[model samples]
Target: MTAIRLFGLAALLSLSSMASATSFVGTTDMIGRALISTTDGISDLSSSLKDDKIVLAARDDAASFVASQGEIRGARLHAALQHIRTQAPQLNASDLQLAEAILAL
Candidate 1:
């Protein structure tokens, strides 16, 4: 009986964690889509993110932006985005998408 209870607890714990992770991913996707829909598609996101260091520099603000559902725009994020653009400027995507991309980075 105890073994059975433990098994059930383990399953429940695993399921809860999976659900939490799924929600996290959903939040990111939702934010990205909303930003894309709201913005005019004139700007382009990063051409390609080869340097992890650049992305890492703005990871905190990116996370905050995602957590806030984009309510929180960080100064660091703008700085990083400009840096990214200067490094690679040929693609096509909106600033919002680029912000989302920076979060993904």
Candidate 2:
């Protein structure tokens, strides 16, 4: 009985850890998608990207920002991208694309 309990506890802990990891990855992906949508100038790029779920997630992230902070344009967009870069330097490629898009705007 004690062994079974220990095994169950271990399983629960493992499942919890997996959930946490998944949440982190989802958040990171959301940030990356938001950057892509911002650069591409499309709120719903899922049709273009051929991945409805992922693109929709990206749109949601971008929309969240717009809802909270008004429209993102000009210096505000640049500042937001900079802050995202600082927070996730691993997303450098997306940052470059965003920078190009900002220049075009």
Candidate 3:
């Protein structure tokens, strides 16, 4: 009975260690992918916001008026505006101006 008890304890420890070792490898891979995805998402969001700022700033009153009229005609532009609303702040300024620009566009 004593020998059986000792064998059981050893088996439990061995299984526990093996399970831990396998999970550590899997956890490392998952963490690595998450970090890469976060970095890429941030970069893409920043670039897009910068482009929107440039387009808005570069345009004159006439172009802006045209853009304002564009709301109905341009579904893609509207979707881009939505992306800006959702993603711009975490990358840069959480500003009233940014919100207004999205609405105006």
Candidate 4:
């Protein structure tokens, strides 16, 4: 289990753009915590993210958004965020948070 978690963390790091450790650490921690959280809406969204075609199609946008810390809201990323908000109105996480979640998936 520890090996699997380490592999997952490694995979996550590979997917990332190698942004400063400080910035991604908090976001990575948030994504890790969120994945195990019991929050209904976010849980649903988090699971759905794995198969979300819209988000999948916007992987580059998500990477950019996360790397830029919400500074770069690419068009597809914006649309994906809108889609998530529409599906889970109760989820109060900011755009950067949502982007990190999407990127983590």
Candidate 5:
């Protein structure tokens, strides 16, 4: 009985973690999409990112733009972002850092 309770607790924790993570990701995606949608803002952002190490951060924002401009296009852009992130952990870290900086801006 005690073992069963522990298993349930662990499952609950895992689900909670997943929900929290998803919420964070969704929020980030929304913000990124917003910035990328603004043409002048995107140009400014690109300039700001020039000296920044995570230069590829703009790609995600670009993908967000593509997604919003058209449904099918957005789906493909989303897939591309997922693929790039998953396939290149090291490269993704720099990009993530650049994204964090952009968010701060």
Candidate 6:
């Protein structure tokens, strides 16, 4: 009986952790979509990102990446994106897809 109880508890804990992880992923997707949609000619991504909590979190993550590597521009930004893709594949995949929707200008 104790073994069965322990098994059930372990299953519940695993499921809860999975749920929380997906919640953050969903937030990432939302933030990415917002960024893609809001960015336009002569406008900055930071303006759109500032209003949302999830985007703020993502920005902080990106800032940390930039701080460690020194300066985020051109190739550096690309490197950061690639790092994010490897570190959090699900979230970065969504971000990349949304980024593709926006024009560079």
Which candidate should be chosen as best, given lDDT against the real structure? 4
Residues 1-105 of candidate 3: C-alpha lDDT, one tens digit per residue: 699999999999999999999999999999998767655655565455555653344334324435565333244444444566565545442323333343444
Tens digits of per-residue lDDT, candidate 6, 1-105, equal 699999999999999999999999999999997766544411344343335344333444455444555343344345545544454443423433323322221
Ranking by lDDT: 4, 1, 3, 5, 2, 6
| Residue 30 lDDT (model 3) | 97
lDDT per residue for candidate 4 within 7-89, as digits (tens), equals 99998887675556667898999988875563455657889778878888778998987787678878898898899888888
Question: Candidate 1 or 2, higher lDDT?
Answer: 1
Steric clashes per prediction: 2, 0, 0, 0, 1, 0
Q: For candidate 2, lDDT tens digit of each residue in 14-91?
A: 999999999999999999987775644522221233333323334434544445553444444555465545544544
lDDT of 5: 0.52
Candidate 2 local accuracy as lDDT? 0.51
Q: What do the candidate models score in CA lDDT, each in turn?
A: 0.69, 0.51, 0.54, 0.79, 0.52, 0.49
User: Which regions of candidate 1 are displaced past 4 Å?
Assistant: 1-52
lDDT of 1: 0.69
Instruction: In model 4, state the lDDT of residue 103.
Output: 74
* Cα lDDT tens digits for candidate 5, 1-105: 699999999999999999999999999999887656554443455465555434354455644454454332334334444554554433423333334434444
Which regions in candidate 4 have their CA more than 4 angstroms from the true location?
A: 1-41
Q: Model 6, stretches more than 4 Å misplaced?
A: 41-105
lDDT of 1 at 103: 62
Q: Which ten contiguous residues of candidate 2 have the minimum total lDDT?
A: 42-51
Identify the runs in model 2 with alpha carbons over 4 angstroms from their true place: 42-105
Q: What are the models' TM-scores?
A: 0.44, 0.39, 0.39, 0.58, 0.38, 0.38
